[model samples]
Target: MFNFLKKKELHEDGTFDESGVDAGDFVDQKPLDEKESEIYTDLSIHPEWHLPEEEVYVYRFLNQELPPLQPNQVSVYGVEIKEKDGGLIVDAFVRNSLSKGIQMKPAAIIILDKQGETVARQPFDLSAVGTIPGKSSRPWTFLFPPSSIRDSEKEIPAQGWRLALELKKKPTKHSLDLSDHWKESLPQEEAQRLHQLVDSMKPPKAGEVNFFGLDARQADNGDLHVTLLIRNGSEQGLTLRQLPLRFEDRSEEVVAEGGFKLKSLTVNMNTSKPWTFIFPAESLKKTGFGFVEMEGLSSTEVMEI
Candidate 1:
């Protein structure tokens, strides 16, 4: 059994320093051409292996160089893995690299096919974690083989399997804390008045949703009220289904669950609506954030305030 564990620590300033054996060093920098695909048999177990369990090969590729940065500075990028159709999907993102003092979010995607079936996927998101530092560009890659696929007993086709990579760039803003710098930026009276208004705001009514922008405010009672704007494009009514809301602490243990409801106004088809929900403040304080998931949704978007 070849068990490998990799870990990286982030500094208080939100930068990540890479320290490892250069596991990705062996991968050729040349793009993956068709000839490379021919080197490995499709869906067949490699004959040289002696281990009882399947093998997963991690490969890293340097795709491109990023713009120059100030001396001795570092940024962090992160990779996330999700399972899809018995395969793994990967996403990557870059953080703290923006010159404007904000973070830039970039994504990279990869897919793998085994035995003619799409068996693995990878999506990378840089925003999920810290970024690497200096003038060097950080390029990363990993592989999930058949042995790692949960249910491999059933044979899948070879032609159906394939691998791919896609990259995209988008704008992202990091949330700012009023106590951290907002007070200094705004007059005391205006700041206090804004704080009072937020403190007095009520929870979203049932069936009413608000799309208040990013940045979440903490109430004195230790509750978090997140407002989201919901836009309806169709002529028919949309029912908001229930999903789980989970809260975890700094240690990543679940501290609270439930207590928030999705409230939205009845939108006539082709109209837009806003909604909001309030969860226990202790939950956010413990975990930093809470998550809401509903069925038939492609993604979850959270605005800080």
Candidate 2:
């Protein structure tokens, strides 16, 4: 495999100097259209191989300029939705606008409601869709059977709902540090996502970090496992040695309170990190509850050590 990573020289001023680097080093060595299909074909067992010949042609298309995909850039854009055979058929465009010819692995095709809530989800062996060339937007029909439908019995409204691709893998990369200007090196979609995530959240006061609740669940032992998002919108990174947390319930009552030791965990400016903290059974004041108030945290005192 060719390394798509670009190596550059970082200077004391945080600017990169590519004086000796050739511009052609970044260009793809082989044209995507010229790539042999042998490398793109997956010989392993796949459910799509059993599909009818006519149905198989729905997603199969030829791409001459198959370019490499930037991480997490593949997405589908829906053009039409119709009811057929007591199921839903989505005519959509599988877009790989970032880079190179690529084939997708098997992944779930998700349908979202008007409110962006998942109404249906079904897995598909996307490799059968064939080699999708880079800078390409190909049309394909995805059939979601009745069994996969979770929405109401009423017919799914075609005009309102949206198409979405589930994150097949957990994201390991986070936003860059305040001083790092290298986020430009990231895929355009990824950089935009991180930027929007930070901007969408009403930032905390200047020079301060906000700890908000993302999710919370009570285990069988009544241990409240809470997932918190540490959002840093400051100009520099900050270290967390300790944080006192109060878990509140739907009634605005504190169900659990604890001081979590973070051991100098650093949160870079303009970045967010999620950490799950388990409030021991003994520490919880309530026995049975769900949906802890994550928004109420805004008014809670933030203690940083």
Candidate 3:
């Protein structure tokens, strides 16, 4: 048995893949190691990512002494904007948190005011920024031509301005390992939203199953009505073989013990299901016990089953 209901950052950097697209827009985001092989695109450094001019810009920027970064954050800071030759020039430092080098490919440079209103938003081809080595900071410049100025009514913000990135959205990655039957009923956007929601959930450690007792109460006949949650955080699904549960009350005293045979019950990977267990009066321990201190069942342990 494991923690029942228990168990419990992608930053602005526009992620890149061999396809030269930003992976940031995808709903299902996972660490490099956990994704399915075919669907996963390694967004790390590529030899061809840096053009001759782009390489020079990154080299010069990283050479400058920079400040420390929080453990895992891709920060775009040190924004300084200027209007030159009837065009806007944005200068800022792009910081990378990954140990692997990243060559930013494409994204929008959005300027916002003090109240968080968009002053100017322009998409720029960031190939010029080139490859930003991991664990380093690089300065890149973007020039929004005069044409971009007319696109928005707000004038260029000088004093209380903030610079941000609007990474382009990529097409849906249906290659994800979700069941086709489940996706059939879901609209495209809704399906993508669910994928994002599920993917954002923090799964139990690899090969660990958490059993949580959501709620429990004593029936009039002294039987125990227990609502339990079974969580399977592993990459593979399994049908519960058996459950040997021992429920303890608020006083930490055993209140019930019953072995439940889950009839062909199945839990998919990275998902959980709820079930109600009724412990007959005979199976319950001494009464007068308060709330329960739910315990684990070895059979439900992610490692064993």
Candidate 4:
């Protein structure tokens, strides 16, 4: 209590002060791990520009292997049109960045008939946005109305139309090399087997009615609980007996009150019929197939988790 003059000075921020320490003193810093470093490096490599008040990015094609289109190359992007109730709708943005000033050009929306003849060719407005030097402007919206096409007495033989963007100047050509992600992820043999199984399990005819949906969740004991909802869509009553339900990877039979024996039940048609079944959680983790077969009815397989 008498040596009060030997007290050290305290900083207001509660941090120790080393004013006398040299600025060149070595300090150890931990290096980032491999995964952490990769993530940081990737974010800095490709920077994306955010659109004003828009959520989606504007680009002709995404995740394709083609070389980046030059500032002058013209390309079209839209969904394929099929002959249905409503005629096809085209919503695409055109991109072209050439010399300075705003360029306006007349574009053609050509529709060809089945006999290789041009049925309709309508003119549309095309504008270019000139913000960055040598950067092409992207088209906002180009619509082709369905009423513009001619209706055939028998059937419309038209396949699809192309919005040809006639360019003033031919830019440098570039080749795009697109790689498929799905092919790389799955083995060729396994992928083919999955495709075959899917092709075989086509949905019933529109008139041949059936109603079904799946309810799946994990239990407290980590087992996957799956419930099948089957509703009768027909007029007559249907009988189900000895229904064999299977889990793809699971070989164990579900224990029932009747010692694993199959039971028959009469389900009235046009009713909200329900059937409950359970499978182990491990069955879903493996790559295999599951099915349910009843007499006088087609067997159905469970594909999705």
Which structure among the candidates has the greatest TM-score?
A: 3
| Pairs with steric clashes in candidate 4 | 65-177, 65-178, 66-176, 67-176, 94-139, 96-136, 97-136, 248-289
Q: Give me the displacement of residue 178 in model 3, in angstroms.
A: 28
What is each predicted model's overall lDDT from 0 to 1? 0.34, 0.57, 0.55, 0.34
TM-score of model 3 relative to the true fold?
0.35
> Which pairs clash (backbone N, Cα, C closer than 3 Å) in model 3?
1-297, 2-210, 2-211, 3-210, 3-211, 4-211, 4-212
- Off-target runs (Cα >4 Å) in candidate 3 are 1-72, 150-155, 168-305
- lDDT of the structure predicted as candidate 2: 0.57
Error of 2 at 120 (Å): 1.3
Question: Model 2, range 1-305, lDDT digits (tens) per residue?
Answer: 11112111112332221111211222232333433322221111133346565443433422222223332255555546667777787766565533466576676778876677777788888766776665455556799998878864766765556667665343233453322333445577855654566556665655557777756887887778886667665666778888788877778788899898976777775577656789998887876566654633553445332
Q: Pick the candidate with the highest lDDT.
A: 2
Candidate 1 per-residue lDDT, tens place, 1-305, comes to 11123211112332222211111121112222222211110111123434343232321221121222232222223233444565543332221221222222443323344433444334435333333331233323344544455456645332223333332222121121243344566687855654454344443333333333323445678776554334333334555555355434335575545744444324443333334457775555454444442212322333121
What ranking emerges by TM-score with the best candidate at the front? 3, 2, 4, 1
| 121 Cα displacement, candidate 1 (Å) | 1.2
RMSD of each: 19.4, 19.2, 20.6, 28.8
The local lDDT score (0 to 100) that residue 25 gets in candidate 1 is 21
Model 2, which residues run further than 4 Å from truth? 1-72, 169-305
284: Cα error in model 1, Å: 25
TM-score for candidate 1, residues paired by index: 0.22
